[model samples]
Target: MKKQLCILLAAFLSAALLCACSGKKPAEPVPAVSAAPDVTSAPDDSGNDPAATDKPSVPVDTSYNPETDADNLYSSANTILIETEDGFYWCSSTSDYLLFYDNWLEEMIPVCSRPECEHFPDNNVCVQNKKCDAYLEAARHPALYNGKIYYIDSNGIPNPNVDGTRLGMRLFRMNPDGTGKEFIKNLFTPGYEDPQWLIFHRGYIYGMSPQTIIEQGEVSGRTSIIAIPIEGDETTFRTIYEIDNQGWGCMRFIGDYCYFWIHYMEGYYYVNWDTGEIIDEQQMGGVALRWNTVTEEIEILYQELLPKDGYFGETAWVERDGTIYVPGGDCLMKIENGERTVVFEFKEEGKHFVAATVSNGIVFARTVPEDFDDPYGKSEFWVCRFDGTTIFKGELPMDWFYESPEFEGLRGKPRYPGFVMTVGDETGLWIEFGAHWRSTGYNEPSADFLVRYDFTEDGGIEYKLYGSYDDIFIEPVD
Candidate 1:
């Protein structure tokens, strides 16, 4: 399931690709998605396959809330509902860089929104919906920081190579009510493809866009993360991080530092936001996932998963109290005062688990789907109180569907979510989704399709698709 990832670029920039090519070291077993256009033999599983190894399986919380909140979901949930002081903040991403993965991000976004579903109905996915249009996908992970909901603009058009004109993606700013539709920066340039992510830090928005280079006229190499000013003109954009001869394995900004892990065959390097540092070039040593600076300490957490070669390990996480709460992954180890009691079962192989940020003392963990090997598909979510006593397994809203930004018909979308935080205000959540169609295949239907579903039914399940593409419009959900 490897797909293309788009990074937004703010300035007209280029990097010097002049690595000696001789001093490169051998690769360790870090999980990486290759640039290959198609799927390869399953690289390393993120944290499942119990029979292969005996790790404590993720605790299965069988909580159910079927009538209202579909706790036992089977398919897509476009609007990721989050509780808040004002109301529920629906988290989502929309961007055009999705063309790289054949709509993978478009497909994946729905998964994050709903998580659990027996199976998503065919032709029901927003990107390829029968008649629905106005489907917006994510350019970068949607960020909730300092009580502001941040996302980039869906300004890009089909790539000229893919289409005929070189349409580009731009960054956008909006208040929670979808009010502030302003162009923070124009991310389209001749050399830079698109910017996909936006991270807020020190009152500035940091983002990354990888420049595509055709090696030997076809092979792809190198990826980089650039920075954008959340409050300035486009000219002042800064490309804070870059890596040579590697792919962007994972990127996230924790607190003041922006973390980018570049995974290469020989291993990976950690690109730090603070001090403009790229110094930590550690051999992955076969540890799953790269430069996992997601936690407070990188080296300590790395060795714990590894400990030794003959053993394999995995670690799962939950950000609580500003400190990353990693239970365990490949190998089993515990640190930090009795807080994280990582046991053997907490190891990767046996238990399959997925978690979101903990709020109000409850950590939300989604169960793995049964049909697909990937738990990400057709799964359900459960709330496990961090106190270590109760798990509230329940269903999400009904009739929800998910698709990645790359999904056909979906222009901007990315799946790896940024973060979910409940603000002080409680919200009346309406997981609004469905798209407006542009046209029929090939000819490019001009019809714009738009539809929506409200979980609480404040607005009944009213939607439209399969008509003139021009008819599509995102009418405000009341």
Candidate 2:
């Protein structure tokens, strides 16, 4: 069951397994996909899951249709979509209209010229179909700059018959409205690797190459941080940094710096983007360090054991201003000048922090009851002021797969919204929400439900659900 969920949510699995080391916490008890989602575990008869609850008398409405819905405030029908400064874009698995939401008019505009044609089978429009010579499969990891959008045009799986030089993933750029699309460059040569991270800054794109084995038959692979010239040929892209690829971790680029880590045991690093220089490094040693990206400095914010014990806890941390807040263990705490101050401690015996973030003077956290013992338990969302005053705390009514009572035991975990792109003072979260599952596995090949959480609302957070897409990438408008 654990393996199956990892594959189901491969994008978030890295943090699922080693989030203790990374500052980013989980928003739900949903276990990360360590591998492909196809792996399954034995059925458990004991109802020890925290996330499970009796079927409620009133079922939450989780579905929406973009085609019929006219309201701009709320819509549930369109899935696999993204919103940028320019407009909102959604790629459908069924429809021919590669949809775009006009930011100015506040309406969805279909970009395809062929009124009768389903835009998918024909890649002439927004999507990268199987028919194209480069054979663009799906668009992933999008970034926006100037007036154009850049993303990973993932070619399908490797073909042994194809030449090595021609194989590997490609970066693509296009207009925000899904016009003037073109390939940028192949991510790697003569080998295959998926990007763990992608960032567009200062007229260049930075990506961390996928892990490769240290040696043939060895488990781990060598990893590298790559930089691509936005306007240059493939030769213009270069490997800025390289290290042993620690499987099941992540690298993130913010401003002009990059934060990197592989797993709990391997430690972490802060690198300078402009010079490809190592700014600082820290070993977890059972301790998690908080880097103040704003101040360009690092601090040891949380430790599992006392200095005498010299150990670290699995707790998670987030930074704002110069203070570090941790929301794991029994109590949530704020660390200042090496002092631990209690903020909001969990009175409940079993719940702990799954994920958290601080933006615009507000702290948003997701927690789950630990008593259930199941990897994914019922999750609660908490919103509070930076001072630790609670604003709102309630169950995050997100059930990705609507499982019947008979199949309740086979339900999937509650997943984190993967794409949390902070735009100025506002924050947007994009991730797969609901699931359509069958006896064998997921009912659909791709995520059926794409949910967006808009934390920029005046009163509180607002979310919209979109469904049934081959692939989707959302980026904040520049």
Q: Against the true structure, what is each candidate's TM-score?
A: 0.40, 0.52
TM-score of 2: 0.52
What is the lDDT, from 0 to 100, of the residue 84 in candidate 2?
43
Which candidate's lDDT is highest?
A: 2
> How much does each candidate deviate from the true structure in C-alpha RMSD?
19.3, 18.9
In model 1, the runs with Cα more than 4 Å from the true position are 1-84, 91-151, 154-168, 174-181, 188-195, 208-213, 217-223, 245-344, 347-478
lDDT of 1 at 451: 24
Native RMSD of candidate 2 (Å) = 18.9
lDDT of 2 at 363: 49
Task: Tell me the tens digit of each residue's lDDT in model 1 across 430-454.
Answer: 2222233233443221221122221
lDDT tens digits, residue span 1-478, model 2: 3223222222221222111111111111112212111111111212333135432221222222221111111111123344443445554433333454444444434443223323343122325342322222343434434445456654633423335544456677655434457866665532344554455544455554555554666465554445554555542235444444333333333322333333232434568899899944433322333222223233333333232322222223333233544443344556566566567643445556545543434545566455333424566766666576666566644544333221143234323323222111235444444322233344322233445555544535565654333322222111
lDDT of residue 231 for candidate 2? 59
